[model samples]
Target: MIEDPQGTILALFAAFCRVGGCFLVLPGFSSARIAMQVRLFLAVAISMAVLPIMWDTIYPKVSGPTSTYIGIIAIETVIGGVIGLITRYYVLGLQFAGTVLTMMIGFTGPPSQDILEDAAENQLTNLISLTGLTVLFMMDFHHVVMRALVDSYTAMPMGGTFSPQGALISLTDALSQTFTIMLSLASPFILYGLLFNVAVGLVNKLAPQLPIYFISLPFLITGGMFLLYFGISSLLEIFANGFVPVFEGR
Candidate 1:
């Protein structure tokens, strides 16, 4: 049934370069917990599904010289990576905010194995990050990323000249926006930590003989935990709501 098997194969591989490249660094997909084989199969399946929709745009591009085809593959991979990095940076920003939140609340428990990765992380930080990621999955954030990947064909096109400058600018903009959003989310905790520490410092000054620092640790953690219990729902709600505008705006 295939009139041009070679061309079809080339087109599919071309599509795979982009989709697989995106998955290579995508958040949940690229998690260390996910096996490489599973990621590869999922990428291949998605590439196959996407190839037909993009057949007209992609097929013609592959019937070119070997050198040109190789160049296209590289460019497509970078384009896909840039797209993936945008989302990755945003999620990483949330993780950073979690770290800040834990510090502010004085929750300095020993680091434990991360729920999603091999690295050790603060227990509260892990909870916040995992909760935010779970909310993202529940809201189907991957669908948004896939939709952006599809639209990227229109925006970047196949075999077009790669723009490192433009790509860098996009990433920088994503970081900037992510920082602002994450900062706002962690502001209350930052303020709480500062105020709580200041009050504790004054108490220590008043009772120099007392082990105020030791005495205050429990209260600091308890207050922080209480704040988190009351505010976590709001934090995640804002975090999830902000993802769309930041991702699409970039």
Candidate 2:
């Protein structure tokens, strides 16, 4: 049944190198909460599934000499990592936006353990990031990533020379687009904080004897909370909608 067991194993490993590399840094899969063993098994399983689909293209590539095989492994890993990074960067951008939103709203509570990771984070930041990620999962974002992984074989064929310049450009463009989207999402809060602070400053000047700083902080927080309550749905909708275009375009 197996004419070339060695070649088949090599081809499967090659597929693993790419798929596992992507999972290494993928957002939800790479979370500290996920055990390494589980990730490894999942990667292996996906690699096995994908290998047959890509058999024609991948089988021929693995029959080369040892040195060539090693090179292909490295190049495939890098390509997968780059693809994973594009998604990671976009999600991290949402986290960064959450941080900005918290600061603007004066939600400077003590940092707590992050819901997804081990690091500490502000409560509001945690909420926004977690909510956005949940929405992404609900929308089946991983399916998109898988589809992209398959399409990548066409875009960056196996055993091709790795292009550092092209990889750098892709990363830079993802960051640029992510920044613009995050900024726009946080703009309303930024403006609210600015105007609220300016008005508070004037009131303090008018009532120099009073502790305006203390008095205004609660109002600032309340206003921000209300604004977030009203806008969060729309904010996440926009965030989820933008993911596909940014990921595909890059």
Model 2, residue 230: displacement in angstroms?
0.4
Pairs in steric clash, model 1: none
Q: Which tens-of-lDDT digit does each residue in 113-184 have in candidate 1? A: 998788999988888888898899999999999989899999999989988999999999999999999999
Error of 2 at 82 (Å): 0.4
lDDT tens per residue, model 2, 1-250:
9899999999999999999889988889999998989999999999999999999989999999999999999999999899999999999999999999999889998999998889999988988888998899999999998888889999899988898999999999999999999999999999999999999899988999999878889999999999999999999999999999999997
Off by over 4 Å in 2: none
User: Model 2, residue 41: what's the lDDT?
Assistant: 98
Least accurate 10 contiguous residues by lDDT in model 1: 124-133
Lowest-sum lDDT 10-residue window in model 2: 123-132
**What TM-score would every model get versus the actual structure?**
0.98, 0.98
lDDT on C-alpha atoms for all candidate structures: 0.93, 0.93
